[model samples]
Target: MNWLNKLERKFGRFAIHNLTMYLIGGYVIGYGIYYLMPNLLNWLTLEPGMILHGQVWRIVSWVLIPPSGNILTIIIMMMLYYSLGNALERTWGAFRYNVYIFSGILFTVIGAFILYFITGGFIGLGIFFSTYYINMSIFLAFAASYPDMELLLYFILPIKIKWMALVYAVMILYTMVRGNIAVRVAIVASLLNFVIFFFSSRNMKPYSPKERARKTKFKQQSRPHMTYPGGARHRCAVCGRTELDDPTLEFRFCSKCNGNYEYCQDHLFTHQHVK
Candidate 1:
C-alpha cells in the first residue's frame, strides 16, 4: 500500500483510485489461474458431468473465470469494467471502493465454503461467474450515475445503459432458475455482498466527524486560490481589510469591475464577486 501513497502524490486521486480496483480484481483472477486451476482440475473440467472431489482451491478459482473470452469480447468487457469501476471509485472514494470489491469477493468465498460443507464437496457451482452478477456492483454504481446514458447493442441498435442493465439482471434470474441449485446459490452469494455492503452502508457512515472536517479542510486547502484580474492584493482596496485579518475569507474576480476586490461588512454590496 506504500505504492498507493506514491501514486496519490504522482498521478493524483483518479489514478490510484482506479489502479486500486483493477489491482484487487486482477489479483483474484491471476491467483486463481496460477495456483487454483491445476489443483481444482484434477477433480473436474469444463465438460458437463465432471466430478469435483471437494478440492479447496475450487472454492476460490470459480471467481476468476470470465463469462466469455475473445479479443473483441475482452476489449469490450475491459472497457466497460474500467469505465464503471473508475466512475464508482471517483464517486465513492478509495476506501468505499475497496470495501465494495473485497466485500463482494469475501461474500462469494464464504458462501462457497458454506456450500462446500453442506454438499460435502464443491459441486454444481459453475453459475457464480457464469453470469455477470459478480460484477453487478460496478454496473449498479454506473446505472445510478448515468441511467440514461445510451449504448449500442451488438453495435447496431441503441439502448440506454440502465435498461440494458435491467435486462442483464433479468437474464441472470432466468439463468439461475434454469441452472443447478449450487449455481443459483452461488449467484445469490455473489450478489449478497451488494446487499450487505452497500444497502446496509446507507446507514453506515464510514467517516468520523473529525475525518469529515479534515477532508473538507484538505479540499479547501488544495483548491486553487482566487485572485484579482490585474495583480495579487494583500488587503481589500475598498475596506482596507487584510487577508490575514480573516484568513478563511476568499477573494475572487469582480464581475462588474476589471480588478479583484474583497468586501468587508461595510462595503459588501460595493462589488460583485465570483467564487
Candidate 2:
C-alpha cells in the first residue's frame, strides 16, 4: 500500500480522467466493426497463436471485442459498467482506477499467453480473454465501497449492492467449478485484479447490515457529552453559537485545546488550535 501511495504521488497527474467514456467509445467502435466487417474480428481477437505467427496488434485489438452479440445487451452492459466505472474513479481518483482496470487487462493478456504455452497453441474455441470480467471487477469495487446502496432489480424489486455482488460471486464460482480448463483460466485471469486489489487495499473491508448498525451506534456513543449552563447541548467556543441557533449545525471539541472548546463544522478544520 505504501508503494501504491508513492506511485500515485509520482504519476497521479498523468491519470486519464473520465476513462469510462473512452472505454464505452471503444465498445461502440468495436460493435461497428463487428457489424460492418465481421471477418476482421478474427484478426482482432486475443489469440496467442495468431500473435506468435506475427499478428502483434491482437494484444490491444482484443480489448475492443464486443462482450455480447445482442445490441440491447451491449447497450445495457455499457451503461451499467460506465456508471460503476465513473463511480470508482470518483472514489479512488483517476490513477488508482486506471491501475485497477489496466491491471486486469494485463493479467488477462498474461493468462492468454500462459494458456497458449500450456496447451501448445490451442488456447480455446473462441475469443479466450475479453473485457467482460474487467467490467465485473468494477462492480466488485462498487459493491465493496457502497454495500448499503440499493437498486431496483429489473426496475421493480429492490436489492442491495452486496446481495447483487453475492449473486455474481456465486455465478463465477459455478463457472469455475463446471467450466473447462480454458474457461476457468480465463475467469481467474480476468478477475485477478479484483482479487489482488481487494486483498491488498484496506478500503475493501466487508460490510453488512449488522456492521453498519454497529458503526452507527459506535459513532453516536463516541460524541462528547458537554452541557452548558442554560441546559444547552453544544456551544461553539469561538462563535458562541448553541443548538438553539441552528439545530442542524455540528459541533466538535478541539483536541489541541487545553480545556473543553468546541467549534462548528465551518471552523472545525480552519480554526486555530487553542494552545
Candidate 3:
C-alpha cells in the first residue's frame, strides 16, 4: 500500500475524475455502432492477429466494444456500475481506483496476447475480451467496501451486499468452470486486481474486526463535534440528526433511494424508501 502511496504522490495528477462517465460513454458509442454499422466493430476488437498484421489500433479500440446486451439491460448496467464505480473511487481515492481498473485492462490485454501465442496464432480471440468482467471486479470491490450496506432485491426485499458478493463470486466460478479457455483467461485476468488490491490492503490483518472497532471507538470519543454555518454537513433523512448532534455517527447515502437522500448508520437499512 505504501508503494501505492508513493505512486500516488508521483502520478496522481493524471488520475481521471468520474472515470465511470467515460466508460459508459464508450459503451454508448459501441452500442451506437452496433445498431448502425455493425461491421465496424470487427476492426475495434482486441484481436492480436490483427495487431500483428499492423492493425495496432485494435489494442485500444477493443475497450469500446461494449458488453453484449439489449438497450434496457445496457442502460441499467451502465447506471448501476456508474454509481458503484463512483463509490469505489471515493472510498479508495482516484489514484488507487485508477490503478485497480487500468491494471485489470492491462492484464486482460496481456492475457489475450499470451493466449494468442499459446494457440500458435491460429485463433483470434477478439470476441472474448470485453469490459464485462472488469466491471464485475468493480462490483466486487464495492461489495467488499460496504459489506453491511443493503440493497433492494428487485426494488423490494432488502439484502446485504456481502451475500450478493458471495453469489457473484459463485457465479464467476461457475462461468470459469463451464467456459472455454479464452473465457477463462479473460475472467481471471480481469479480476486479478481484486486479489492484489483488496488483499494487500491493511485490512488484511492489523485491522482485524476487534482492532478496527477499538480504533473507531478511540477516534469517536476523541473527535470534536463541529457545527456548520449554513447547515449540517450530514443529516439523516429519517432521524434528521447531523454530525453536530453526534460526530460518532457514520452517515451514508442509500444508493437504492430515488433521490439524493442520506441516512445515519442507525436508520440506513430500516428507513422507508422515498419512492
Candidate 4:
C-alpha cells in the first residue's frame, strides 16, 4: 500500500489518537479566561489546594490550560500548533507522535507532583499546565527535518523554520530566567522532553515485516542499476542505493550476464547510457 494509506490505516479518526490536542486547547482557552475574568471556569471550580492534594483530574486539566490571555496571541499559538503538529503526526506516525507529546505532559506532571509534595500544598498548580515548551518541542521537531522550509510571516515575508525555532528557544530561555518558579520548571520540563526525544530517540517504530520485504525488493531490483565508488561498495551512481545503510542486502553484478562486474553492491553491473 502507498504511504498515505498506510498512515491513515494506522492513525485516522481515532478518538484517543487526537483527543489530547482538542482537550488541551479547549481547557486552556477556558481556564486562561478564568484567571483573567476571576468568575469564569465556575464549572471547574478549580482550587489550587485541591491540585496540591493530588487530584487526578489536574494531571489532565493541566495540559489544556493556556498561559496567555490575549485572544490574538492564543490564535497564533493555536494555528502554529495545529499546522506544525499535524505535519509531525504524519512524519512520526500516530503512536510515536502521541508518545512524544504525552511524554512531555507526563514530565510536567511529575515536576509539579514533586513540588507539591515537597511544599505541602503551598504552590500554584496552574503553572504546571504551561504548554509553550510542549509546543516548542513540536516545532523544533519540524525544524529538524525541514530546517529550510519557509512560512509566511504575518502573510508577508517568508521565514525559515530554524530561525523561528531559534527565536522561540531564546524567548523560552529568557522566560525561564525572568518568570516565576512554575514557569522555570515548565520550561525545564519541556526542554527535557525536546532533548531526550532528539538525541535519544528510541521511540521511532521499527519497520514492519511487509515494509522490510518491500524495501528489500526495492534494494535488489535497483542493485544492478548503477556503478559506485568502490567495486564492493559501489552503488548506482544514478539511484544512489548502497550497502551503506544495510550490509546484509545481497547484490549482483548483472541479472542477465554471468560475467562478474567491478561495480559496488548497489549497482554491480546495471547501467544504461542515455541517448
The models' CA-based lDDT, in order, is 0.59, 0.83, 0.84, 0.63
Candidate 3 lDDT over residue span 1-275, tens digit each: 77877999999999998888888899889888998999999899999888889999988888899887777877788989999998877666677788999999999899899889978895568878988899999989888777898988877999999999999999999999999998899898889999897876774433233455677786676444323344677778888788888889999878888876889999999998887
Model 4: per-residue Cα lDDT over 8-119, one tens digit each:
5766555255534674567567665776875544323223467546665755655555556577876776777787777666555565566677778788767766656556
Off by over 4 Å in 3: 202-275
RMSD of 3: 12.9
Clashes of each: 0, 0, 0, 7
lDDT of 1 by residue, 55-111 (tens): 455444444555456557766776777777776666556756665676676776666
Candidate 4: give the clashing pairs.
24-64, 28-64, 28-65, 28-66, 224-270, 226-236, 234-264
TM-score of each: 0.56, 0.75, 0.74, 0.60
Candidate 2 wrongly placed segments (more than 4 Å)? 123-126, 203-275
- TM-score ranking of the models: 2, 3, 4, 1
**127 in model 3: Cα distance from truth in Å?**
1.5
Better model by TM-score, 1 or 3?
3
